[model samples]
Target: MKQPTTDISSQQAEQLLQPINQFLQCRTPASWIEQAKQPQSLPILLKDHMVCELKAAQSAMLLIRRYAVDEDSGNALLQWLKPYEDFTYRLKGNWRDLADHNKLNKRMVPKSTKPYSQELIDKMVLLIKEELHHFYQVLEIAAELGVSYDRITSSRYARGLFTHVRTYEPAALVDKLICGAYIEARSCERFAAIAPHLAPNLGQFYFSLLRSEARHYQDYLSLAQQISDTDINPRVQFFAEAERALIESPDSDFKFHSGAPV
Candidate 1:
């Protein structure tokens, strides 16, 4: 697959990291960035970070359902996610319940003991755990800020990639994984891009996310490779083009994952 150019300059990266660091610093107080830097700010910054965690977990779950798991596992995955999705979309469920729900680990594998590999399961489990921890951290921050947990409308970022998923079986999975890789890569790039605009604490937080995001892109790509015997370069190119369109297009909504500022 064609790799996207990494022509961004060091100066540009530094500029981006500054704002992110500032954002983290200012997370506690309106002008915290200008004040003393302290360890106390971590909890506050982590509080708002929970949303990102949940979204990450949701993405991994979708991958497992669409590609790795059998039909029964797929249904189980949907059921497992119903509450979170409901809360996210404001369909039902109290947001507070998310805090108390059991963390997802050791997912139930089907009884068939088929030839299915556990690689996807292991990777996804770790991803889910990290995401939930991030979620918890964000909740803590929200609690500190006295910000009530409220459902917000989702941006078009995810839908844009998902819309391109093929309706067929394995092809659908291949396409989804390619899209997943793009999303993960984009997130990694954005974290690096936006870090400079943030405060010190925020910068560190976003920087910390880079490793996992990079790994996620690789994991998605690996999965795509495992499933397809044919060369996936063409499909990768197809999705890369789609992803670039989404990233470059004008989006009115300014979200963590949305395209360039409108």
Candidate 2:
């Protein structure tokens, strides 16, 4: 396969990362990138990345089902996701079969007349579709590179943010969305940060994803603001700091979005 051009300069990368960087409380440490860039790390990195992509889609699907859709529609959403979820969680299916399921229809619809519900449904559905496709692409890349699939433990990144979520209507949903924003933003930042450290083909692929990832962060933040009746900035800040702590702290295990080297 021909390598795609990844001629991104340091200045350009920082420019692209600036909005996300400013929004985030901390940067991915140099040591983490150093650890990730090693040839031995590619398999686990790609595996975790593939999982992360699927998880992003799953998270978005869950958000739409839980907050935006009717009971019947939520069931439909679960049915739509069942094939992919089975592949990831159960390891019972192959990623290639998702070719038929990737194109989404109107199976999931909003339950309420609340304007934000449909808006969220629309945005998150699109996100789910894109993320699932990215997951498939990652799998194909792994196959080409001869990397076998094995389930790995999730990093502390997401759980740390989840621990801070307030357990109340709209507040819980709002906090989840804010957390989603931070996750997406950090993913985008890390893609840029690590791209130059990877081989040409892989670096190019990661760099190519920056645009969609940036938009994903914006979509999550927009939905959070639209869903809440009150200012969501405070909650946003809360997760920003929480996310920073997760990234800056020492981690015993290394995975994508892992913290500082121990």
TM-scores of all models? 0.70, 0.93
Runs off by more than 4 Å, candidate 1: 1-52, 70-87, 91-102, 105-107, 110-116
Which regions in candidate 2 have their CA more than 4 angstroms from the true location? 1-15
lDDT of 1 by residue, 1-262 (tens): 1111133445655554443333221121212222213445334333324555677788888767655677777677666666766765564776668666535533556334423347777677677766665565555545645665665556677788889888986788778778877776776666675555556554555666666666677787888888776788888877767776666666665455555445
Backbone steric clashes in candidate 2, count: 0
For lDDT, the strongest prediction is 2
lDDT for 245 (candidate 2)? 87
Backbone collisions counted per model: 29, 0
**What is the C-alpha lDDT profile of model 2 across 1-262, one tens digit per residue?**
4343334555666677879889988888999998998899999999999999988988998998877888888877788888987888888877789878987655666765667888898889989888887788788888889998887889888888989889988799899999899999999999988988887788888887787788899999988898899999888877887888899999978989899978
User: Given candidate 1, what's the lDDT at residue 199?
Assistant: 64
